[model samples]
Target chain A: MNRRALLGTAAAATFSGAMPGLVRAQAPGIKVGFVATLSGAGAALGTQLRDGWLLAVKHLDGKLGGLPAETLVIDDELKPDVAVTKVRAALERDKVNVVAGLVYSNILQAVFRPVTESGTFLISANAGPSTFAGRGCNPLFFTTSYQNDQVHATMGQVAQDEGYKRVFVMVPNYQAGKDAAAGFKSRFKGEVVDEIYVPLTQLDFSTELAKIAAAKPDAIFTFMPGALGVNLVRQYRQAGLASTPFLSSFTVDESTLPAQGEAALGFYTAANWAPDFPNEVSRRFVRDFEAAYGYVPGTYAAQAYDAAMLVDDGVKQAGGRLADKAALRAAMEKPGFTSVRGNFRMGANHYPVQDFYLCKVAKRPDGKLATETVRKVLSEDTDPYAAECRMR
Target chain B: MSLNLLLVQLLNGAQLGILLFLVAAGLTLVFGVMDFINLAHGVQYMLGAYVAATLGTLLGSFWLGLLLALPVSLLIGLLLEWVVFRHLYRRDHLAQVLATFGVILTVEDAVRAIWGSSPLAVPQPEGFAGGIEIMPGLTYPSFRLAIIAAGLLVALGLWLLVDRTRAGMLVRAGATNAPMVSALGVDIHKLFTLVFGIGAMLAGFAGALAGPVFAVAPGMGDGVLILAFVVIVIGGIGSIRGAFVAAILVGLIDTLGRAMLPDLLRLVMDASSARQTGAALASMLVYIVMAAILFLSPAGLFPVRRG
Candidate 1:
């Protein structure tokens, strides 16, 4: 070939390669990037999420909303910086139209700017930081999980409805911890005897248990997650407070109940979704998840599964083009899909306005640990901060 | 606080202190005698816990887990010493730190790969699941009490071994002057291997014991590892006696500070601010104490050279 023709062809190839998504727009279906904590501490929750999400995609036969979809799952390793880097790469390089699967609030907050700036529709499965629920809400962001404070608030209301007068609360010392306590106090009519905050990673709670024992409060409420929750609850039982009515929020759940053994039994916790939620979608999900993964799916999994459904519905509403951000966002905000947590509706802020169930850990007839939905504590609950969100 | 609460907290502090000592004993020894920095010492503790939990589950008895964990822990330690730690001994501290840090990453990832990164319950041995009333209205977990008793027994055994035995004498002498001990025709390499093995066993023992009380999961050792370092630093780097004292002090300060600091701060500040400041300060309590001690005594509280 002539030198000039060869140079022109080379330049054309380079330009098309740099802008692959624009050049080859309609060939591949919707691309969704999933980033979550898949490899570090508390990774069980992340693994459940990844599994649940993939199961949904698998069930749909690799198609989301009647369109061929490509999902790339990446582990954030529970690090914010890693999450940012991965999300950025997913957006800029992979050209994913949608991003999902953020389990921790800190991670969601960290990757918020980059994901939104890239104009990718970010649907969070687990984490729903309050910052994003309020004035900080972005049009590009949506959450399938409850706001961080909502469950604690529901637990507090449940405590009051159950006629617990004097309560002692404990939580890991962080923003979420403070929010938890504040949320509890918001609706709780009873007197809070004491509120103790410990290091988030503290494994040993003998001294605190002793204090709880000494205080002899009517009920004990806490918001410890992962191993911390396992240790604290087990230690509490070991301290001979099995008779004391213990309450928790996101502390004793499906993810932690296996390691917690009988210690978590009989305690009450509040969450937006549970395996025994009675809805057809939830029943099918829980049964299929157990059959596929050997263990029952936790709240994290349920939420992530719902997130996948949301993306599917959004893609359908957008006529199989998730690149149309406005239509996708509008479809996502509408309540149509049969969510595992029934009666699902998105608030103006893009966070779910759903019922929070007060669940009690009980042994099933077959002798397996399971959470029985006792009652709905909050009905069609909208986050208090949603009013401040100007997403409309 | 009431007198009962105070007494219980003091005992809790002692219990935590002893656990810290069990993990720190080997770390201090390795650091002191060999002049080696093995950050992977914490991973040894983690491996010990995992081994014990797995064995316990497989054998269906906690006692069996304990019985088997010691030798396994020692073997792993010896293996690591032979393959990786031995080479780093002659290198600079920075090299040792980096290499050991790499070992830490590898060990943590390996555990995660095997166990799937979820917390596992190491079943408390039969008859240790309940609490014992130590005094009027001051009931504590029987398992924790047993941990305290076991930790003390280990401490006693370690004291005798280090202070009265021939091997311990060599270890102590080596800590003071490694070259001088080597010049005396002592097989320094063999001695280091033995010391490393024993240290690994002690840390493993601690981890196994801690399995029932703490959550058995990957990276569980990292937090305790930092605390163990603080214990070794506060207690002299090579001084077993110093570690004993410093570990107890750290345990008490940390426990009491977390329990009492917020209440104390509430007296001076608003309730919310008190909690925020108190939690921040409580976390820093041990480091602060370490700094104060170092400022007062540059050589740890019980320097082996002085001993």
Candidate 2:
């Protein structure tokens, strides 16, 4: 064989029945591959996804099929190339019938092609990019979380109602960040003074904070999560520019709250759930998690826990049978389970049409980092992109 | 923009540049002297931040945390060299990168497993928390000004140490002629360990110092590592003076570019388009600058002991 042919042969060895990864007996079992950001700064979200899914697996005794099963989990590392490779391996080598767990919209986009081609059902735990909800929505692909824009829409409602006359918007240099700024604009009826875009994983923000300060807007709205949030809070506080109200989505949470401390005292963060949600499931999970992990679980963890419960309940409702792929997909569609978020239901886009809550960081009487449910910012919040979905 | 705001941003840019210098200094030297691509160097920086955060939490004093974290970081560096890095000394750059990459994975995972995924931070020392007036209307954060001072002092100390001390002479010699230095019966192994430890200590100190400014999170060092690599590449690996000059250049360019690029673009394009285009361009400016520098000078501005 020529060099190209030999290379192709070696590559073809990955998917052929003759490959070592192809297992005959486990073919009937539901092979669910989870694609998530498991490395780099993106690992924070992936870690939460892994924990939630693993917790679900533990509760279900590693059996998702109501029968023998195998779960193929690979770290996409939040890179496009990695996602494509992982998706191919999962479909060809692992022969997974179902795949889930995406933290970023971009990664979801990269892996969706391979997933759709293989007829594999993709259950996105997070990252409901607008495109996928409507015209771009493939029947084989479904989002388990809200569309990316819905979270920002929640913040927009709050901003418009709060009577903030002028605002400044900040987001990472990425698709969702742009969508977030645009999404906020969609519902907010206010003049935006400026928009600052920082690179993802940017730890220093004094310069940007200075820009926001100089703009002197009524409120500052941003969508930076995990480490980015922590950096922004510290820089904001240090700059002695605390008078301006700060509102954010997915930026201020248990993961970043500890780093911000008193600096996070008044910042308002929009989220679908808070640990303080007065529900048995929420309380139980938070208490158990704190007891086990010391730190309070973030909203990412909550969503993760919810996704697992949704899958678990769906599998059980399907007569404890995931033997058939279509039956499993059917069971998942009408998932009947209590999530950590409470009263969970999947929408037509295979995403959640859930309520968005405004959470403010407030120290308890004992002075530990805690968040209070300020109000339901947006009720029955649905992704704007879902209208484009033409599910076959 | 208000004069005070402009002054503060400028100070912030300078402070960031200094911190970059502290990190890039050791990285440049290690690559220059050892001819080893030590990717795990970033972890030492992260470990410094973590050590400081952990100690501050335990002792309730950020200064004490800073002092303790340095030695801990140094100890980690030594331990790493003894167990892992020492074996790779004779190997090529590929082996070193892979091994150090393993170190990064193991250390990062260990940090996550131990510290949990939540970000940890150390409070800025109260003594250094006050703002100082730079001009009639402008004031800068005391902690940040202190970083500039600390970074400058470290830079001077590094120069003196490398130029005036016997160990420094050996290192300078090693960078040029590793085999000859080893043949001279200087106990090259011990020297290498010492160099590695000091390099680790420098990175750690930088991390610990930055803990108050930046959140101590897992994989925080990855970005810094890339930037440090760029700095070393442009400054000439293993050259302290080169790293210093290059670090400041990179830092100033990055900070100023991010601040000014959009405005500059707005000159020709619409404000909104300019801002968006500027943001995308600003992100790539530092890398482009690095590539430009490398293209012009393959061995960097100051090629250490190599001719």
Regions of model 1 farther than 4 Å from truth: A1-27, B135-138
Q: List residue ranges in candidate 2 displaced over 4 A.
A: A1-40, A50-100, A106-122, A138-142, A288-295, A308-346, A365-368, B1-5, B32-37, B84-102, B116-118, B121-126, B130-139, B166-189, B236-239, B290-307
Q: Model 1 misses residue B68 by how many Å?
A: 0.6
lDDT of 1: 0.84
Docking class of 1: acceptable
Mind giving the per-residue lDDT tens digits that candidate 1 earns over B134-216?
A: 65444577777777788788778888998999999998888778788999999988999999998999999999999887888
Residue B202 deviation, candidate 2, in Å? Answer: 1.1
- TM per prediction: 0.93, 0.83
What is the model-wide C-alpha lDDT for candidate 2? Answer: 0.78
